[model samples]
Target: MYLDYFPYPSLRLHQDRMLDAVYDTVSSGDHGIIMIDAPTGTGKTSSISAALAARPGKIVVAVRTVSQIDIYIDEISRIWSKTRHKPEIAYMVGKQKICPLEREFRGESVYAGCARLREWSRNYVSSRIAKGSSSIYDPASDSMPEEEPGYRTFCPHYLKSREGFELNGAVHFRRSGRALDVVESLKKRPISPSQLAESCQGICPYEIMSLYAKDADIVIMNYSHLFSPDFQDIIFQWLEMDSEKVTLIIDEAHNLGDAVRDMNSRILSMRMIDLAETEVEKFEGTLGQARLDESRERASWRREGIRIIRLLLPRLKKFLESKQQRMAEGEALLDADLFRSFIYADLDDIEEALSNFSDVAVAVADLNLAEGDRENLQGEIQPSLALVLLFLNDIERAEKDDSYQSKIAVSGSGGKRQARLEVNNIDPAANIRRITDNINATIMLSGTFSPLEAYELYLLGVENRAKKLSLPNPFPRENRLILGTRKATTQLEVREDADNREEISGHIRSLIE
Candidate 1:
């Protein structure tokens, strides 16, 4: 196979084994995990593709990012171009993640794309306006400018073509133009599509994996899709394909824990709760018309719940703030597991109050109120309340299911904090054993299943244990020196040093010189 299509030159032994294991599992009618623990520089992609030749149904080689996807696609296309066995390949990502221009040009809804483009354009225009530039309002309606339109204004096909597109026909240039020109134009006008795809909910990165998990021979996607409870359900649905036919290969496995945590966590900031309260309060004073008798006690409960949320928000903020401080000072005061507990606790409290508030809000909505009081409603509060209720419901479902675990946490830096969660309660060992019991044969491989024993530790309790094998690096060992550095700067210290502008500048100068 012409594997040189890979951006990297050669495949590593572990990658080869993983690919071989994929084929072996399919042939033997069993499923297994291939733990690839290799440092960077191993040609994992080449090895995976090479091994897939033995047994191929629908092949999906999932990776973390689109760039990685691109590299894989390019390599696969090149190899399949020369090989006899070629599977149909299609690339899909989340609707929001893909370029709006591509979506619209491809006949997908411009609503999301347009919304995003408009938001971007608004920011750009607002920024320009702040800098005292009104030229943003001025457009060259007479002719297409030599300069390409901004991404928000540009059409997907135009951007993809790289030769740029024109504002064809009679284009109405807005005095205070919306950010997304394509969306704005489509709003006032319409375009004829060259062709149409099957339903256009406009797939996103995660949705594609969910939709095609079972049918696609070589599935490609993020680790989050397979490991996260919220996402994994979608993947697991597809993994039901005879158990033995599917292989889960995680790239950048080091980040798997963080990804899982993110998929499981939920964060409803104090601002969100405050906004909900403000909106819900619009129904106040009109309780006479509200159908539910607003007893002093019920009103008190609603008021108290709002108060509790207000009080609770500050604590959550304080907790997050303290963690931020500790992080800034370069300390390990918090971890993924601990932060998860905090989120769960906060959600529990929020759910209690929010549910009470929602009941009150619904009661108020049921009551006849003045148009002004009703109009005082905020847009996001109702949805926020509903979303919180939905999350709580999902939590309850997982709690009883016995198949999933819920892990939530507060994580990240000062300005960039994240509330995260991950659910994976099902024992992988039992999972493997059950599948093996059904299928009766298995093989696991990877170029980076290093130290070999580590994989054993990971898959120790797994059922129908397969024979273990270790291959050389498949390249000259002397040609590469594996340097283990002990003095690597800690993540916290690096973050701190990065915050100091002068020090960063000095470091840059030293490096440049």
Candidate 2:
């Protein structure tokens, strides 16, 4: 059965065993987790053949990097050409990579800029429809007014992409024939994000990939698309599929633990505080003009909120400076309560102050965007104040959770010294299990999961529910060479020493000779 979808006419040694294990685990649905520890020559990408043979629904493959995405795309394309088994395939990267407006929206996050442009596009279309001037499908409906600032206010690509789709009250796309044609063209072959962006001249490449993914049998994406909860929610919603119905494949499973830890961590730096202070000062000058239509009482409250942020900035800088003086050039544990107390000493209610700060940060960001001065919008687009709030919020959330550790690290030399506050996640099992427990089945592939029990029990938290398969190197003993050295040590403490370095170089020289 697996051979039906397998791209090559033959499988490598032990490749059949790996394929059968995946097939049985997926088909039986008794065990929802499987770990494949196959060495370099094992033909691991062919595991998709077994997955497709067993499951009839969508398969979401998570890769560690952008380059890994091409292997799957190439394999699937080969499958289509060789076996005549064509499964619709699609891939997505972060919006920041494919968004055309990223350069125009300077310091703004692609996410925020995309949202604003989409809103403007929708409003423009709705207004045109209301006046009976054009329908959603009309080409002219996507055109900007002769007198209006088109690119500044709305994205032409976004408007053109949505020409054939009417958004329901729930925001689901009710696509027409034109939209279907676009999706069909995308399915003619598997395209990388860069290729997709290049081909999509006047339309939003992200949206086009999204539209195709809704109907794709297999979708390839980065690790964050599945591991990060926010990205997971957006991707699943865009695909219009439930977690229970989707089968997930994690490529390079060995790196998952570190990836999860990185995703949950947050950082705040002295430089961010300095930029935020500048943002607040500029925002205060424009507050009067920005809030003219608001009630006097509300405007006064906004002003007070701005003042609080301005005062807090210097205090934050001072705190970091003090910590820098006491600590060496390394990291030290920070007491969450002590940090909170020091930062919030002037506020009567800590929660309310945080809430007010969040509100002011968002207001300042929106005001900066509304001013129509992209050149001066430096950090206002992403708003360092918002980042500060996020860092503090994470510290608060992890206060009682032992799985998280808060630390302050001082780096660089005397004149270039910089201090940063960070909240690090020590355990990744909980986050990993969060996704594994929801999906129909999870197949983790890696070339380095040696001592398989470590990954099965500890890293993946799938001890009882997982079927483990470890394959030996596929190449013959006579065809390969392996060598090692015990004379040289690359340990951090001694690796930089002159004798140790010379010893390592000597070994390399002997090998070359």
Candidate 3:
């Protein structure tokens, strides 16, 4: 079956082994995490496809982003065009990103030559949707693309025990054959809001991952989605159920730790707290008798959170300044940029102060979730908290690292308003272990897992049942060259002189050319 679908001549020995390993791990029913270190040009995608063919349960292949997902999906469709077995693939992206223009294109409504209008359609849609304007939406309802009348594209591939899990390609809607201009299309075939939505099946990364990805073969999302608490519930759910049975690939593994750090951190900012107060004020006149008092209390708490941070930041800044002055005289003992190296030192305290403010702001914003702002609160608070907490936690933890000891400080009095310094050494082992205990298997793969042994040790925290393999670069070595240069090397030092500097510059330019 693979022979017929695969356009390539044959799978290499290592590719076959990788495929078999993945299949065998799934068959064992004990989640397996295999890190295949196949370098670029080694038919990595082909090997992955073959593995999917072997055990086609509800597949969820995640790329780092939606665009990459589109590229891979298109490539797969083109490759599988002649095959008898083809998987039903769906594309999901963020709701914010799926502009109205793109929806029109998918629906085959936006006329050609008006590319500019197509681009702006998303902004139009956002505005209309925000305003609850039904007039503009009415046109979409009038024109509904009829479902295709043909035998659905069905994949012959099947897992041994999964009888009902069939890849039904017909579930997806194809765009219309006709492309019409805005005026003509609107005249001939008005589309309804429901039809527009149906034709536009795009959902955001979180939406796809959390709600729409039940039986998805591939889920395209950001790195943050996998590690962040906002999305960790879903990530854990997937891992806990069949993680060992899954192939969890981190496309950009270099940023994985940073992403994890980002996911873990939280911030509380003055602006955020202020925004909450503003939003809560807007709801003052509309809330119900039942929830009015609770809403008011929440608003007050948000205000209190903001006040605490505002008072804390000025003191934190003065402390850091004093430390900086004291340290300036001790250059032999410490590098000038030692404190400035970490986030806490570099981000003028205002930034960290604002970031921390954002954290409390999130809680404050949540308080504004009165009966009037219910919908806004429902959709916004979680993401806001997720975003703010990441910064807050990062700032607090980064502050704790003894390497940046000069940056640490404490101010403000006790009683729900004290400012205490928080620090983090970020134990990769402990963190990885926590994730591993939650999932079946953890695979950390990247092109440059520098100090590969170090990475292996790091993964040891989560990858107790995993096997690691490294492959050489698949490209010709001669094609890739490495060169190193330093800013202060080779060239003669040019003093801020009149004649000698110009002569040196000309010589450097000649050498460059």
Candidate 4:
């Protein structure tokens, strides 16, 4: 039924079966999760054609990396050109990549700087609209207003994007303006994030792409776009569609488990602690020079908070050092209780102390952005204090959960030795389910899902509910070679034996010859 949407004039071997499996699972009334293990030559991208043909609501194809997005774009372009079936398509990349001010910010400060600029731009545009002036600020013709005394800078692209939009309560785009024209143009073709960023010379690329994604039939995004809770919220809000109405297609699904675990894990390193100390000291040095009485009071409170954090950092470092001394140059399970007790011992009220430190961290981040310090902007600035708080918070949350394992890893040797606290996620099933359970239907495609049952049960946690399809190799037997041997074994126990090593080496040599 969906063959009309397929790009090619004819389907390759086993392609129809793969496409039928996707169609059946998605078009079914109930929510479904299907894992497809299509071999390398099976034309896996065509699964997108099957999804489109299903007419599933708002198909979202999430790839492992930004580079992988191009494959889908090429396939969709083919569908449009050959079949004349043009579905509205939009793709998103991380803000850091598409931010117009990326060159100006120079480092990890770009995100903080972007946030600061957007806040300023929103306030500036609001004031202008209130004063009966044009909300849109033209960069080419109109000179930018001087920066407000306290504010460092404004983003003209962001300001321009605010045009014809109601921001009083909920953001509602006005349909009868140049914004509509831009949306229509974007819908005409699948534009990559870089091309979108370039075409949006005066408007915010992120904002425009988000707007395009809202009405798009298909949105291509990164894995983080769906798995990271914070980003997931933003993308869902932009789509303006219920999760139950969204059909998710995860490309290269083999990476999902690792990606989810990495997302859930928290790491606290000595380098982070040192940077947090620098931020606190720098912010504290500027405290007494502030103006208003209210401002002074706030500064005084922030100073007290930083003082507590300053005292806490050394203790935390000592804890990590002590753990390092106990372990060899490798990882060992950590006692969450021991770490928790150490933290509690330092503060009378653990929650209050954490809250104070969090407030101070925010203030320091703002101060650093305002100052635009050359040293701070040179690298990604993760407030070490924040990392400490997050690690502690994760430990608290994982107290009863066996899926999370707290560990300390010692790396390098003697003088160069480094130890870090980690709350590792051993099982990503719960996290993955949180997503798959809510969506209408999910179709996961990968070339490496050989033990498909393992992914169905462990990684996705969709055991009984999921549909599994493993397509045979499309290439003919004579055209390809497959070989195996039991003579050489690389098992840890026997691999080091002289005969075993020589046999393994001989196998490799024979294959090469």
Candidate 5:
């Protein structure tokens, strides 16, 4: 059915199977999870795109990295070109990656500096709109540049796009009096990030791309776009769209568990504590803080910061001094059962301590929000504090879920190190449900998503309504050589042993020869 729209010369057996799965899922109008295993060399990308092109509603291909976005943009361009009906396509990336205003601050941290600039831009635009100035973009305004002959001069989507993309056809540019369709040109030949950044001279590329994605036929984005809450407000909402139809393709899904964990994992360190203390000391002595009365809400947070520094910190410091080993030598795990034996007794007290430290982290972070220090927050303090808070919150939340296991570890020099807590969601399947639950059709694709049992149970949350599909190698294997030899073990401990290492090295040498 998709032959004309499918751009590939010929589909391999596995590729055809993938295409069928995607088409069938869409055809059945199913609303459940699908674990799709498509190994390399199967032309999986083309098959999936061609299949999805025929599906109704928006398609959000959530990939792992910016580089993956590049691949899809190219592939989507190739496959979509085959179809008589072209779908609007866009890629979503972080402002740090796409921000246009960040160019001026080349040497400094662009993301950190752009925060204020973005805020300023929003205010600038809003204020102009309020004053009814001509600078304010008016989509309905018939005022437009010269129209190109072939391109649609007036696409409804162009109105929402402030960058003059909503034109009689895609926004046209004149090169020596000849009108050129920018959007059509883009579909014909996709540009790299640098080129796109250059083309987006004035308008915020992030906003422009997001506007395009909000109405696009396909939106390719990073994993964080779905998993990170911050992106929900900015990017994911545009991608995780709903209609009578929806399909979410998690590419490179072999690392789904890791990606989820990375999204959920939080860590705190002694460095944060040190920074908190130093910031508190400096903040308390600052003239601005001194002028503020005790009635100020910030003063209370400042007191909490001081309390963490004066009281909570000493306990950690003492414990570090007591322990002979910390993260430097490796790590020492604190037993869960011994929770009471630690300095903090009841769970309430632990929560309170963690909460206080979290407050201190907040105070320190807010203190850095000062004009001079805002940019450094991203480059320095915020990361450590963010991890620390994530760690604490993870422990707190895991306490409520039996599926989670929490262990505390101590790292760094005893002189002034904080404890590191690691919380592993033993069953991330349950947590992953929250992310995939709403989608009508969820496609989890990976090269190594085998042992379908584990994947269905652990990755897909093993829903009764879910469909697990595994495709066979499409290519003939008669000419392929599958070689294996058991010689020396490469297990961690054994591999470190001198005799085992020598034996493994010998086997490697023999294999190479």
Candidate 6:
């Protein structure tokens, strides 16, 4: 994994050492994560990236968010300028950030929109051709105009993927000829979400980049992609990446633990139940007896699901509302049978009913149908169903697994004392292992790994399977300075106090001055 074709003329003293450490460990044919900690600006990106690039397989760069994209873009561009091996690079974000059909786009409705676009973009040109042949234009006798459809004229990004560039009178990516003609067209694919939105109209960023990632040498994405089961399935099943051979380069390594926790963390609230109950009431009130009788069975699952939840609520609320004082601690467990039954008997039906309800909700919102029944289906029902489903799934797991601890924490009471039931994986190691089990190796780099032992034991589950490297700060004596201050009480309560806040503000001003 040593860098044979790095663009940089020289690496910093610490960077050089890190580069070698990475190369040695990876080249040793190790099978586990390699953790490295160095102060910021140690050239960690260049060193690790160059090392990974030197190897044969694709480099998967995972960051915490889209805001930090330039790190990879700048590093790769700088490196690519100097190497003949211009690795195909691609990045992806959730559909709300990339899709155009939704109100705010992004992947807000990705589960619905993405499926539509993938099928739409593929058949767009054929649909156009078939439409044109029978109407305004002749198919067999006349050559079709460059854009027979008006949408293609205004939406070039849509057309680029729909109708592949014709090189030598044949479609480029369709039949595989000279890729030269469509190189510029392919470059239009955005590297980030903002760029994607500004790229063009009618273009699905997630769909386009997914295609690019399928053949890419390095696929850059948020750390979230790995944390989500849906995205994990997409990685192996949709993107067709060979999980056993693909290497993982997880940046902001310290945050992975928290990210995993946040990803797995779920809360099903009383407010959701209230909203769901309101929606059901609205459906019944608006539809009336005649219409309700006609379509009641269609949404029978929804009412049954809600009824089951109603049965469990009072019992759950009482248990959660019990004597407890920990701010956000997992204090105790509840009856998992209630959650498990919901999962097995009602979860799937609830999901389908929620989806069916959403279409009706949208119809009501748009005033396309049932104008009198404007509130027939409330928008909150689907999300409520989703949260409830996730909550029940966690509960089901808690019943079966010893590692997971289920708790009911305070979510603020309204009428009859509200609570939030949650299942937290006490040790994230097992879950983290499942994430990387298919991968060949994982490399994690962070500016600080202060509590390395805890991270290894709790987060990675790789205390024995991973290698570690901790280097001293390399800044020179004059370049860095450490300052000390005493008599400052910035504890939580003190910060909340006005007098303490003023004192802290004065100290900060003095320090700055």
- Candidate 5's TM-score: 0.67
Q: Whole-model lDDT for model 3 versus the true structure?
A: 0.42
**What tens digits encode model 3's per-residue C-alpha lDDT throughout 1-513?**
344445466666456665555555444434455555666655556544544554434444444544456555554564556455555444334434443333433422222212223223333433443455332333223222333322112101001001111123211111112211221222222222223333323211222223334444544455555555556556536433365444454553544564555445443334333444454344333344454346565665444444545454444444345544443322122222442343234345545455555646454444443111111201332323333334345553455553222123323344322222233334444443455444433344455666555565554444335666666776577887654434323222334455666665666786679
* lDDT at position 4, candidate 5: 64
lDDT of 1 by residue, 255-328 (tens): 44344445444444445444445544554444333523457765677665555544444554555565544443
Q: Name the top lDDT candidate.
A: 2
TM-scores for all candidates: the values are 0.48, 0.78, 0.52, 0.77, 0.67, 0.65
lDDT of 5 by residue, 412-511 (tens): 5647554655677666665566667765567778877887677777775654556777877766788465555575674534656888789878877987
Poorest 10 consecutive residues by lDDT, candidate 6: 371-380
Model 2 Cα lDDT, one tens digit per residue, 429-477: 8778877887778899999888889877666655666788999999999
Off by over 4 Å in 5: 50-54, 94-110, 116-194, 202-204, 229-235, 238-240, 243-245, 275-328, 336-387, 409-419, 463-465, 483-513
Off by over 4 Å in 2: 95-156, 164-180, 274-311, 361-383, 483-513
How good is model 2 by TM-score? Answer: 0.78
Tens-digit lDDT string for candidate 6 (90-162): 7866555565544522433434333333334435444554555332221223333454332232223343434
**Sequence-dependent TM-score of model 4:** 0.77
Give me the runs in candidate 3 sitting further than 4 Å from their true place: 1-7, 54-56, 65-67, 101-212, 235-246, 279-425, 428-444, 459-465, 475-513
Write down the worst ten-residue block by lDDT for model 3: 154-163
Q: Cα RMSD to native, each candidate?
A: 13.2, 6.5, 14.7, 7.6, 10.2, 9.3
Q: What is the lDDT of candidate 5?
A: 0.57
Order by TM-score, highest first: 2, 4, 5, 6, 3, 1
Better of 4 and 5 by lDDT: 4
Winner by TM-score between candidate 5 and candidate 2? 2
What are the lDDT scores of the predictions, listed in order?
A: 0.42, 0.75, 0.42, 0.74, 0.57, 0.56
Q: What's the C-alpha lDDT at position 344 in model 5?
A: 52
